[model samples]
Target: MLFRSLKPLLAGEQHLQLIWLALGSVPVVEFAAHANPDALVLDLQHGLWERTTLEAAIGAVGMHVPVIARCAENSHGAISQALDAGAASVLVPLVETAEDARRAISAGRYPPTGKRSAGGVRPLRAGLEAMRAADRDVAIGLMIETVEGVENVEAIAATAGVDYLFIGTGDLALSRGTSDSEVIGRDCERIVRAAAANGLPCGIFTANARAVRQAFESGCRMAVSANDIDLVKEGFLAARKATFEC
Candidate 1:
């Protein structure tokens, strides 16, 4: 197994991940990509990212990091494109059933098992052995955000090729008509148990001190912190406020 596999082995595993907007000068993205973190993910669901900007950002960060992409959806084209872009793994959003999780895995794997088209200059040119290792180790993370997703967490976790069952707490709360934190924590317990049982890793998003502790205690080895925009905005506001007060 790869070094990235360490995230899933320990109970209450905690990883500090930074989520990037997938565009712009991408200073923050580059910083986090090179940071001494276990893993990081590029968010492409929002319109904030475009292919050109994504290319530039990825180039700036280089390919030394354990980088993964959260595709717009579970579409094969999107997943395949992300892999070509040099993502070591793909996080498929809104996975609600076993089939949904299965499709995401298929999109990540090569032919003979999946329909993913052969491409990507990076992987193709990186040597056949490297590519094969990547294919074997490429993580397929599924976002369980819907009520159906929560309900089928066990089944989805048990699916082959499914590596991480990432609980999208924000959406999970909204779907279940509960507070974000409350719903996330409640559902996290179930998802974590399911993941532990299936010998898979569980992922979660951490915001504050409380959430960080909760996620770790809940068995989420891989955790994503706040996004780039939010962090920048918060940093700017803090600096501006301090200057004005002085």
Candidate 2:
């Protein structure tokens, strides 16, 4: 629970952070949290994960750090289930318009505001007050990956209840037909400015440490660095290199 208390403050301002899970498994996610990366993202969107395993993973990260899950879609039921199961926050992906952003937020929040159902168990049962506190401080990051999303960046950023507008650079670059371009720097800057203009935090995903730092300087407040398979692959590759050299 070293970084458990820091989540509340993340909601208060545009702060810098590193999200260490994109293709991570439960054990991998837990390990990263223990190592004290700023945060972790349980990617239900683009991974082979069962709901039960996902719940277990969330439990593992519970109270240790802010665990934000990326949902399969902006499915209200899935959002509600994740929240009730104790996810500190949700990141909805491929949001292409303000309406998409609105729906995603609606799925996460409760009534008078939105329609997240009331159900509690496991991690949620142990710390109701604190969980509510975390929800109040929850970071609902929306992924702006598509060309349509980039075009609608302003509108999406303007949507109420969107805490962070994450620039999914890989997908965005692919959509723009310039995945290899140095123009990414300029493109990201544009999106960052859009997020800033709407008073929302800006986030990005990059494996390259240099690019992560560059994103921070370029106004990206949050970033996803590495995931399970890739992290392990890199480590093994480095180890093999070191062993051969030695």
Candidate 3:
């Protein structure tokens, strides 16, 4: 499976540069795949993705690059749907407690490990062996964004079956009622430490390449470098400015 390539990043041996896709376009997804990012995240939370597009996008790019679905919520249905759509991993947002972590993790596994029902075109086509492989290879990530989440980071990290802990810095800043970098940095550091102590890789949502570098330096193995929509806008603005200036 293409997702097997991601094992190194998950194992903390290499840094992962994830490109966030919010536009729900297969062409865009394919373009991102050609660019060869470590992973492409289909943002179902804030992105424009319905079931059909999500499945299509995954189908188009899943063979070349691993597609990670950032589920809109931390629920069994949401997690299962993403996996059903052929997402190599599922990122559950707003996870606030150890129970929340467990719930998200459970939604991605099979019986005895999770409650994920056997369905979805990809899994069905792949057959029983694929189902077993999905149970073992499908990565589950929990976002630590709320104040309660930061407070309980250690326990959340300790939760069994958790593949990685991701820090949503934007929401976390709002939860704390302060955008102070130092304060958020402290919380991020704490989360990273907890993940490391538990022998799991940590990931962070970063705004740019510099932030991604900073995140890696702080012990996070994965970082979202940028989203497709923002990159589009930036490209247009830069082109306009360059044309006018010239």
Candidate 4:
């Protein structure tokens, strides 16, 4: 609940798309939180991070902006743990059907709305009100990553409690067996349309700022602007060239 409210996103304005910095370490988390992009993405799905890292990152961020955890899978444990550790949002990956979307939603919710038990570390520290407010505060992002996912995009988007529909272009390409630009464009369009029809925002994963901007033009309202490793690599490469080149 410490992360900023989801008012703009919930209000459905074509406002500035949130540029989130992805990170998995304490120092990087603190730096990114200080730099203060739209939000922070903890890459549990693909990043080599454990539970302790996520907890430390959450503490470092301390609600400057939303800290969203992109979980490893679409499961209750994965979804709920991130929420319980005080992630304002959770991104569930590899979702292929409406049921997969539904399961993710149910897992993150409370008893009446979901099966998630109410014992998050942050919530406990904040006392009763935070726990009660959690239902309204937690944002749920469901990823559409496979051919089957694309085929059922509309149904999945229409599922309840889905705050956003995110496209994992890399995984989709792998699943579809081709990385053709045209095919990815078509897929992005379809997923964006699905989210629009369901009154939700759309997001995507991009490797660089050029692609991130292009995705916004293609109707994605948000993108992964940078990750810790990428930033370090880019900085080192630039410095190396500047220092060594004649």
Candidate 5:
């Protein structure tokens, strides 16, 4: 709870940062955390583990930096458990409407503000103050990936307590059935504008340096670098190419 959430980073001058999405392996995740990325997004949705594994991995990250768990879905229990597991924040994916965004936010916050129950691991270990701090220090991130999301993005961005909107444009492209630059760029620009209108930062899951540059140049704030799989593949290809070509 003492650790600052991605909210501050998103609001700071250094809006550019890396987001790690990986399986719920403690050592592997900890290694990513060790690199001190701007934030690490635990891919629980696709990771090969139950929510319990996330709790263990979060402890392993040990406040290295902001650890955000991308919950499997929009379930209230899942969101509550994610934050309770020590994640500085939880990203609810496929959030398409303002109501969906509101539901996710309500589940993440405490009573009066939300229906999230208290007495997570933090509270038991660090006392009542820690549980209280989760609401304050912890942030909420939502992903707008589908067509509906893009359509109502303006209202979603305006939702209070919604920290930032991370664009899941990979799926967006797939949905549109065309990786056309013009199409993607147009959508990205619209999303950025929506976030800007409501004083929220916009983030993109970047595929490379060029994508990162484009996101920043187009008025976006956060640029989540490529995932580990691509990094490993690119590393291997470069190393192999150097040896063979040289």
Candidate 6:
């Protein structure tokens, strides 16, 4: 029933690197945890994770490093399931307005602050103190990826109970109907400024180490630099090239 909290890392000024896990393999998650990144994100939205595997993956990595569950949608069921599975934080996607952000926050929190139900196995096993700790520490993050989201970024950032803001750059680019770096960069910068003005940490989904570093330079405290599937592909390609050269 032990839970590792990500609040300490989020509160600091240092840049935090997070590995995104979408393959839904416990071994892959376990290996990522061993790499000791600042945190690991379980992508439930587009990932291959089922309920049992999600719980098992979190169980395997929760003690080693904090886990942030990126819910499939901004809904109570999605948010609660992730928290119940022992994720230290929940990231809700497609948050286009302040109301959307509020809804996500309400879903992630418990009792007076939120409407999260209390029947998860972890809660029952951990008891009152652990539940209280969860209420006090579990972070709720909202993703700003749509044009509407970027338009209302400031209001979304100011929403009470939102622990952080994340930019879904791929979706953002798609929403804006352009892949132009300058256009995307402007929106990212705007979102970062909005988060800073609200005194909250901002994060982004990056393609590589360079993007991650650029995100940090642009005021993002957290960055999802790589995901399991892409890493595996890269590894295979690199190994194949090396073998051929040899």
Error of 2 at 190 (Å): 2.0
Consecutive 10-residue window with the lowest summed lDDT within model 2: 1-10
> lDDT tens string, model 1, 1-246?
221432233234445454545444467777776555566577888637677666555556545566667889999999988777777677899999999988988888987888888777667777667776767767778888888998998999999988777778778878998886565677778888998899877778666657666676666776765556677788999999999999
Give the candidates in order of lDDT, highest first: 6, 3, 4, 5, 2, 1
User: Model 6: residues >4 Å from true position, as ranges?
Assistant: none
Residue 109 lDDT (model 1): 90
Clashing pairs in 4: none
Model 5, residue 137: distance off in Å is 1.4
Q: Is 2 or 3 the stronger prediction by lDDT?
A: 3
Regions of model 2 farther than 4 Å from truth: 1-7, 12-15, 22-24, 123-134, 243-246
| Residue 135 accuracy (lDDT) in model 6 | 76
Positional deviation of residue 4's Cα in model 3 after best superposition, in angstroms: 4.9
Which sequence of candidate numbers ranks them by TM-score, best first? Answer: 6, 3, 4, 5, 1, 2
Supply the TM-score for candidate 6.
0.97
lDDT of 4: 0.81
Model 6 lDDT per residue over 140-215, tens place: 8899999999999999999999889999999998999999999999999999999999889999998799988888
Q: Which has the greatest lDDT?
A: 6
C-alpha TM-score for every candidate: 0.87, 0.87, 0.96, 0.93, 0.90, 0.97
lDDT, candidate 3, 152-234, per-residue tens = 99999999999888999989999999999999999999999999999999999988989999999999999988789989999
- Comparing 1 with 4 on lDDT, the higher-scoring candidate is 4
Which of the two, 2 or 5, has more lDDT?
Answer: 5
Q: Candidate 3, TM-score vs. the true structure? A: 0.96
C-alpha lDDT of residue 67 in model 5: 81
